[model samples]
Target: MAKVIVLNKEDFEKLSEDVSPEYPFLKDNREIMSASPGGLFRCLMVRAEGEKENMLIAQRKDTLYLGYGRDYRSFDLQGVPVEHIALEEPKAYQEHAVFYHRPSHISDLNGQNPLRPVPERQTCFQVEQVVVLSDEQFRQFQENGLKDDQIFLFDYSDKMWFDPGSFCWHCVLVKGENSRDGILVDAEGYSYARYAAFAPDCDKLRLQDVPVHYEYPARAPEQKKTRKRKEPER
Candidate 1:
């Protein structure tokens, strides 16, 4: 998942007018989208993409919607929850959500939408098995022969989603053939170290999503890494 930047509705509407002027990179799209999710009460989701320095923009937007118990751009039980934003694969777009009021009554842990899955303390990507590439297993790719980087070693892990204030919800640990310290890669091949990963590089790395698994090894405790609720880097 990409970094989502939630913004107040009024503030979101004024993104091109106010925020874009200072940050000329965002000036390209002088159109503030009507990305309101369902256009329900106050919860809205605008598109944020095609720009560099997304991290810096998110940080700046946070300051705009700081107080009021995060009502301005925080809770949206009916719409895209923070879990979806925090725990998905790394991508270019960012969510500029605007919540008029926090859905304090709605269960943040349990989702109300039937189509979408609710992330609980149990939802995660658990490593069921690890395969060590054998010599005979190395001759699969066509034309290019077997390359070391082609080998994939996913470390045992669990990316259970935590509270709404988390960005490190789920990530698969990848150990490449030439890797020294190993790599923590998201579904989009974004490493924990923030190295850009092309899709082709991680084409063979397929990690399964296990909402809840007890047959595997011990799972990582919920909220251990996400307790602080930090945002992911761009």
Candidate 2:
């Protein structure tokens, strides 16, 4: 069993905006109503259960209704005690009401774990550039004495071969730098990496791109020799 953290409506509302900026779609959607703190709190409560399924809700006309999963557990929001009322399942409700699960690994609340307390200062990563490379190109990068440390971003999305569907982002700490780069890995093993260079000029190293790359590590001796030989005596 995991310990839960309860955030009140006020705190939840304040944090939701901060959270939105982290997501590209939400940041672009100006018309979308910002999620209420109560709603965000409820979502986090449900997420702590480690269940990635959509939560079920019973709406009472104009008033928004909240409920547990198919189990039909009832909950309250802003003094409104939600009651379970059955009606023809509306597709719009199904889509809009359903809150997607972000997975438990990244959602864990342990303070000791580096990845647990995400959305904190340490987890932040700036963006630099987005480099679209083929598998062979990536391999060549590896062969050319490029170390993973030199590259800020590494893909860990579900599309990749070894994703846990957590969508948790990680940072690569490079020496001689005050901060590290951020990397988001989805369940399918697909990855999006970001670096400090990606930070906007005006921002104090906050804003970041969906995916970016930084520097790679040093090359091996043989790799250095091969590069020297290929230099055409220049």
Candidate 3:
């Protein structure tokens, strides 16, 4: 668990200098400051291993939201019925929505397992497309489509186990640039915070398709008592 520290512009700049080599995005970008007041910023502490990554996004407004996860889903920016975002796969004419959710299997509250499953909630965000001038082919996004801000989803049920001092954990979207190889950004500090950006023109993109399942634990049986023993005692 990492402690939350509010950094002034100078502190943020200094911290950026310290970690910018590995995460070059923090080097010369003025836009990083856009995450102010209640805007989103990545935590510079935790790292995720291989496919099992974790990331954190934080906001400082009237309220706060956070999310952390490894695997993520993809979504279409232009589509009908917002529920379409939850669709299992991307459709050919229809746009798609994609993002990550903590798979439900581990959260099952029943079964003989002593580990109490954490409760997860559906947190949604709208994805919009932006052009990455650096890369002729790659597409960029504006955080969560806000004028200058982005939104994220989080599950705080296990704050006690992972981050006892914090109230919740969150995943956030950050502006990224396109490189010759792929979309790139300096997210090493918050690698645990998995990121999912909207894919434009669903033709080439593949969204993670997960089967939905629900489970309910069986109720405990009531105890039964025998009456024959009472007569012998008398």
Whole-model lDDT per candidate = 0.27, 0.27, 0.26
Q: Which residue runs does candidate 2 get wrong by more than 4 Å? A: 1-24, 29-121, 148-234
RMSD to truth, every model: 19.8, 22.5, 25.8
For all candidates, the clash counts are 3, 29, 18
For model 1, the local distance difference test gives 0.27
All candidates: TM-score? 0.17, 0.19, 0.15
Which of 1 and 3 is the better model by TM-score?
Answer: 1
The candidate, 1 or 2, that scores higher on TM-score is 2
**Which residue runs does candidate 3 get wrong by more than 4 Å?**
1-96, 100-123, 127-131, 136-193, 202-234
Best candidate, TM-score: 2
> If ranked by TM-score, best first, what sequence of candidates would result?
2, 1, 3
Could you tell me which 10 consecutive residues in candidate 2 have the lowest summed lDDT?
A: 91-100
Candidate 1's error at 84, in angstroms?
10
Put down candidate 1 lDDT per residue, 18-94, tens digits, no spaces: 44223322321223211223331221223333222222222222232111222323433344333112112223321
Task: Score candidate 2 by lDDT.
Answer: 0.27
Can you tell me which runs of candidate 1 are displaced by over 4 Å? 1-5, 8-210, 225-234
